[model samples]
Target: MMDAREGRRVAGQRAEGVAARYLQSRGVRILKRNVHSRGGELDLIGMDQEVLVFFEVRYRGSGSLTGGAESIGYHKQQRLLKAAAFYLHRHSLWNHPSRIDVVAIAPGITSQYRVQWIKDAIQASP
Candidate 1:
């Protein structure tokens, strides 16, 4: 039997895979998956045309109280931003346009999972 942590990790990997395929079908070229840095981790990194995209993949089971997107609270967003910045600095892509996107996955009626892609979902406060 799989332990709770292992089960959750597997589920998250599956969701990230699904999100990657879904994005690829929509013209986003995936660059990397599970990018970890000192700051934080980026679930998926891709290019949407000329812009670099940092994707945060969130999955929620059918019985969960909170939706997938809603679970990304303030601290989570800050971490994502920090991670994205670290990625940019490491790659020297500061001049390149970039945005943070969220891919929320939930149980679907017809499909095994339903995906909601929110482009530029989180922005840095000015």
Candidate 2:
């Protein structure tokens, strides 16, 4: 049997995959995933026309936003913002319109996981 930690990791990965598929289905062009820099790490990055979106993928076993979206507290938001800035500057996309978004996935027993997309989820200066 897998350990609790491993199980959680697997679940999180599944959630991220779901988030990726969901975004792709919505016609958001994916740019990158798990981008790492000196500032921080960004879970996913995508483009929606002129807007460059930085996404944070989260998973909870409940059907509410409380589990995943709420997990992105203020500090986490700050880090994500900084990370987005780093990514933009590195890729010379600083002039592009950019925003932060959250994709919350909640696993279920008999049904597929639920996903919620929050556009412009965080407001912090780059």
> Model 1 scores what on Cα lDDT?
0.97
Residue by residue across 1-126, what tens digits does model 1's lDDT show? 999999999999999999999999999999999999987999999999999999999999999999889999999999999999999999999999999999999999999999999999999999
User: Local distance difference test, per candidate?
Assistant: 0.97, 0.86
Candidate 1 pairs with clashing backbones: none
- Cα miss at 111, model 1 (Å)? 1.2
TM-score, candidate 2, is 0.87
Could you tell me every candidate's TM-score relative to the true structure? 0.98, 0.87
Worst 10 residues of 2 by lDDT: 60-69
Error of 2 at 90 (Å): 1.1
The ten-residue window of minimal lDDT in model 1 covers 38-47
